[model samples]
Target: MTDSRDVVRRLREGFAWRDTPVGVFADLSGWWRDPELLRMLGPSLAGLHADASPTVVAGIETRGLVLGPLAALPLGVGFVEVRKEYRVAGEGQRDGADPMLRAGTPPGYQDGGLTLIAPRRLFRPGDRVLLVDEWIETGAQASAVRRMVDEAGADWAGVAVIVAACPPEVGERLGVKALVTDDQLPG
Candidate 1:
C-alpha cells in the first residue's frame, strides 16, 4: 500500500498550488485547470478515506465541502456537513442550540458554543466517524466537531488532513490520530 508520503507526492503532481484569500498564504487545491490533475487528486483524497476507518465522514463548512464526500467514498461511508446556517434559541431535539454570536463571525453563523451539526444526522450513537479537511491549522473547528460527535456518543476514529500545520499535541488534545503529517504534505 502507498504510504502517506507517497500520497502527498501524488497530490503535488496532480494539483495546482494557490495563495489563500489573505494574499500572504498558499494552499493546494485539486486543479480545475487540469482534468488529469483533478482525476489524480480526487482519488488521492479518497484514498485517505480507506486509511481513516470511518463509518461516516464529517467535514466543516467551506473548505471541508471540497473533500468530505471524496474521503467518504473510499471508506464506503456516508458524508456529513457541520455548519451553522441556522439559528436555535435553545438546544432543540434535532438542531443544536444556537451558537453564541461572536463579534466577527458571519451574519448567519452563531458560535453554537462550539457545537457541530452533522448534515441530516448522518452519524448515530457509537458510530465511528472519520473527520477530514484540506488543512488543519489551529484545530478549533475539528475540536468542535469532535465534541459534538462525542456528546452524541460516537467514536472519533481518526482525522485526516492534506496539510497539518499544528504540532502533535493538537491531535492528542482533539483525541485523534493525525493520520497525515506536515512532512507528508505537498511542499
Candidate 2:
C-alpha cells in the first residue's frame, strides 16, 4: 500500500498553474499523465470513505467522469455520471428521452450557475452514494448533486476530492474528504 502522504506529494508534484488570457488556471494534466499517480488515485480517494461502504460512486461531468470510475472500481461499486445541461448551436438545452433528475447550482467560484442532470434510474432509494471529483472550490456543484441524491431517495455517503479549496464551513457541511488542502498547493 502506498503511504497517503506519498500520494499527496506525488499529486502536488504533478500539479501546475498556467496563466491564460482569462486568468491563472490549474493544469492537472501532469496528474493524469503519471502512471503511478493514476494507479494510486482511485484507492487513495476510496480509502477515505471505506467505512461508509458507499453503494455507488457519482462523478460530475468532465474531470469527475475520470476520477469517479477510478474510485468506484476499488470500492466494488458502480459509477454514475452527473452531466451538465449543454446547449447546442442549433438546438437549445439538450434533454434525452430518459427521465432525468435535475438540480440548479448556486453561483460558484466560476460565478456561473449550471444545471446538473442524471438518469433517474441510475440511483435507487436507500442507496449510499459517494461523489468523487478532482476539486471542490465552492461546493456549489456538490450541493446540487446532494440534492439530486435526495430526490432519488438515496443516502449521501459524502464527497471525496483530490483537492479541497472551498471554505471550511462548506467542507464541513458536505462531509468532504480530500488528499490535499488548497494551502498545500504550490504557490
Give lDDT per model, in order: 0.61, 0.91
Question: What TM-score should be assigned to candidate 2?
Answer: 0.92
> Candidate 1 lDDT, tens digit per residue, 1-187?
3355555555556444456665534445443455554444435655654554668887777767767777776567788877653443254555573333111222333333334455434567878877777777667777667777776677887677766777778867764444455565455
| Model 1: how far residue 36 lies from native, Å | 4.1
Residues forming the 10-long window of minimal summed lDDT in candidate 1: 99-108
- Please name the candidate that would achieve the greatest TM-score relative to the true structure: 2
TM-score of each: 0.66, 0.92
Model 2 misplaced regions, further than 4 Å: 87-96, 107-109
RMSD after CA superposition, every candidate: 6.1, 2.3
Best by lDDT: 2
Error of 1 at 155 (Å): 0.7
Give a tens-digit lDDT track for model 2, residues 5-96: 88988988999999999999899999999999999999999998989999999999899999999999999999999988763224343566
| Deviation from native of the Cα of residue 137 in model 1, angstroms | 0.9
TM-score of 1: 0.66
